[model samples]
Target: MAAFPHNRRMLLMGRHPPAHPCEGTFMSFVENLIDQVARATGLGDNSRKFVGVLASYIFSRPDGFKGFQKLFQKAGLGGIFESWLSGSPAMRDINAGQIQNALGVRDVNAIAEKAGVPGSFIGTALAGALPLIVRSVTAGGTIPNGLPSGLAGLAGKLDWGDSKVTHLRGNRKRGSFWRWLLPVLALLALAYCGWQMRGKSPPLGTPAAATAPVAMTDGTAQSVGAPTFAFQHSGGKVDVSGTLATAAEKFQLLDALKSTFGSDKVTARLDVDASVKPASWLDRLKAMLPGLKAEGLKFAFNGDAVKLDTTALPEAERVAVSAMFRDQLPKVKVEGLFDRGVEAIKGLKAGYSASELTEALNLTTVRFDTGSANLTRSSQDIIRQAADAIEGAPAGTRVEVGGHTDSQGDAARNQLLSEQRARAVADALIASGVPAERLAARGFGSNRPVGDNSTEAGRAANRRIGYEVMR
Candidate 1:
């Protein structure tokens, strides 16, 4: 419905040059699909509604799977729908372009001739609707980001008009000045934007009075005193004592500071008195998830003034706690500490005491298969339970995925297999939206066996995934 200007240059990139249309042009795909579906359904009103609604859906879904199943059911085609939405590996590679072509056709006759379906069936049941049905994918929007495959090519063929030389040809090319200056201009623009977004607040630990220092009235200062920070949660409490000049400054500290990797895992509480219980400040902590795109980087924020009470973790994870903090928290900062503190923390991590590492080493594990790293269907529920339980763990807590195997065959082979299994499980957890740095995968093979290698049940128990809480 929303017509876009046809960029003749984009059209030139098509396989047959002027004969083919621009490849993977989203707007054209939607427009063409709407036209085809309208013709195929024979119900003019329904066809129009379907096109408008579906186009809206496609545009809205960044991952391309919003309301896919329901659309198919509405069109009385649910069987093909199931195969697509279930995330089957084969289904993951489906092309949106193919469906677009199918939807653009006005007559079922076109599809019937090409697809081997009967004319009577198309006329009565599908009519012109076959193209629309094809356009409405069962896979939702899992189309791979690449040049068109089978489906895309088909759609292009349907949507594109034959060659017209005038539009495709161009005499002028970008000038040398423009070409060289473009990248430099882009870099300058990026630098300016980054500079604008730099920290507005003073360096961490600068005297609180220098910036947003709180102002206290003579009477209120005498009675309630200055506001302070408390790291306490519903189940635990750790008090941070410091004087801020005003409530406004205290609010800024509470809202602005984030969690640091090496910093202790402490909850924030805004308390009037030490005797009063601290309330949960979950609304204040800052953390981020990975991007849908593979190339995107992961970023996290850790607050200052809070340090982990390391004694609470399991022994294994406690060992590596120093390393994790040192390796992961370089860019992270606390209020009093600027980047210097981050460097100091990194130094401390290298020579972290045995007790510190032991405390940090605490962890939990979930096992996977032997030779194959894929998760069994039966493992889904177990993983779900584990994910739920780990969601609320302390910031110091790190999850280690240990893959175990029964004592059988060559030790080297078993060890390799186990490691791969652990990595696979770790990948799945990351895919499920867990932080990658918080997880580490290792294969222990038969080295850390809990049961005798002779029996089947014992072997099964030996081949398990174990989880431990880091100190």
Candidate 2:
């Protein structure tokens, strides 16, 4: 195997010859080494400069090297970094998506901005060069305590020409003009031959009749711009129109509207636009709506504004829903409906059985404050009714209180919160004259959402308390 040239090895190892002193900071040394390697690898000047800047930024961070190693492992490119460090030829490549996921969107964007490169290019370049850079800094196997020094002398030792093979027979006389002229003549001959071939090629920009454009049907042509969606709610009825990006989104939106308002009360005329791709940020906004529906309020998303219709809801519910939209979807403007009336809760029978009481509890809507396990004051009346029904059940009956949450936060944290909420509700029921041993509390977190978690209404439905009765 051919060994790396002496100067190349020295540069990779961050060692300078005896004549030069280590005068600059650790970052400067890293930058210098990066520039050399980037140029050697045939990167353009701008890309090479950016690579050096990016490397400096990466290595400057605390735990930078360790963090990159962890990222490599997470992204399944650990072997690539390992191979580069071991001086093996088995280094692997990484794709853009893995890099994006491993480094996180924020870090990737920051690096792109600092490097003055497109975010997409940064991932490709980093994946291509990071392994080699890491290998050089670590020096074969072990990472040094601090950055390597004495990189300045590397410039004087580098040879940009092909490797020269030494003859062993005798010390041959060097510097003959004829020896150089032969290679130059061969290069000129090759260039002439290439030029001769180029002259035979067809002229640039000449059209080929066989490549004529074909007429496309109107339906096959691309849409001019992104499709628009408009929603309007008045009284107890909701009307949805305009275009939806996917058939699935259209179905989901209409289903949610019908589920929240009666099927007859909602009407939609939405067209599916295959040309428009769904925006991720818009999807997140759409996810916030299901919870609002659970509160007896309706929203219509139109352009940059959202019209909130609370005509069929009580004054308290209207205020609460408005606050929620303001907090969750801060970017959109909120317009409220003037009409208001409280929707009465259907009362339970006086002598309901345990099973009937459990069924009633499932139908009842009990709400809590955002991120809090504490039940809202308005929910106490519903809880009291549930307590009364439970008290009327047969003697020696047991009840199970289950709590859940929407899938909007960390799963582990959501699980913990759900458990706490369940316990809190169970405690409330116990304080309302139910026997302590007769009740069991459990949390399902966001695992058992009654509706789609992708919408606010669905999350709201998920973030609820459920009851089950056992003998």
Candidate 3:
């Protein structure tokens, strides 16, 4: 393998000489030596700098001469040391820090102070040798125990604050040293990566191993200036987050989503449901109910049901707007302005289909008493048409024949008269073979006025019967 720049520095510093009789196998020698030093010093299974430091320190040590010579001889590069020594100072300077780091001193100044080098040259020598020095002390297995006897007190002072002593004693098990010293750094690095990757997808477990970020043209990846609507699926429900700026915008967005995701995919939430006034296309026509606005309209889709949040939209006009949409939109899907991926509503609207209603209800003659609950001969045809209209309703349907009267007498008596009239109509249906279980009679005595009670046309409109589906 080709030598790295730092490896070449190690070679220049007399750290990685080839061995004898290995016949030009410098690469093998370097690898084996690194492996041995790493194992002996407990750094082989760890970081890259450990080996670098070990090599520099061993080469720089005075006693290391014969050891390195043997290493060179073994690797068949014994003749290259003199040639390596002639290299530039840059190589020396870089390796110096490696050695110093290995030695557990902060930098070259501490090493020089320990070595008693003073004056301008001390800085130069320390700078050049810092890497090697650090390597030597740090590589020697925890604390260096063999300082000169004369410096025992000073060495004792160094030992008091020394991490190596505590680490060696406390970290005796295999892999314990790295577990004690490096795990926190590794964990912190991992946490930083995780924070950066919050919304983005991470790899199976590690943030550092995450997939590359994807660019979303429609701004799904990140929220820019535009509104971001996202759905998170959990349990059986999907929580929708983010917002639409205005009522019309909210409606448009909701309409688009209902069109794309089939209204069943998500439940919508809004801050102000009843207070929003959704603008309509007819607002421009002042002559057709001018000054009216949708002031309190708010809505959400929850699976099969679209719920209106009316608490915020407390105004009458807004309430009407909400009711209108609630009553109508479910019948037909309306594609509005903000159509992105919207297509169409899936099926025909659900309500009273004329064919189905006719198939369920039986019909014959229907009659009403003249100005009372008494039967009359002329009213049979209109009653038959009403029965035929509801004939197709399902078997369990609780059909009602509701009656109303004009303002003619006391409120109490009028109520009784209208109720009797409804019963008369219901009896006619029952007589004509409509099942009694499916019929109900109700009466409103001028309570819900469809037209003015003072006019003849109004009275005619008030005296009417209606059918409703109540299944």
Candidate lDDT (C-alpha), each: 0.38, 0.54, 0.39
Please give, for residues 64-120, the per-residue lDDT of candidate 3 as tens digits. Answer: 334433443454443332222212121112222232343334434443444444322
TM-score of each: 0.23, 0.29, 0.23
lDDT per residue for candidate 2 within 1-471, as digits (tens), equals 122365457667898533321222233334444554443222344544555444444434445456557666777767655665533433443444566777777777766675565654565555445655665455424543222222212222222122131111122234443453335334333432332356543111111111211111224333354444544455545555555565455545554555555544554455555666553225545565465553334454544455566666777776566556555654444455221111221354566667766776776655566777877544555566666667767787789999888899799999999999999888887788777888899998888888999887787668878888764
User: Number of the top candidate by TM-score?
Assistant: 2
- Number of the top lDDT candidate: 2
TM-score, cand. 1:
0.23
Q: List, in order, the clash count of every candidate structure.
A: 50, 9, 44
Report the C-alpha lDDT of model 1 over 165-278, residue by residue, as the tens digit: 111112124464345334433433343233224546321111112222122122322224323333322122122334343322333343333222111222222222333222
Worst 10 residues of 1 by lDDT: 288-297
lDDT: the better of candidates 1 and 3: 3
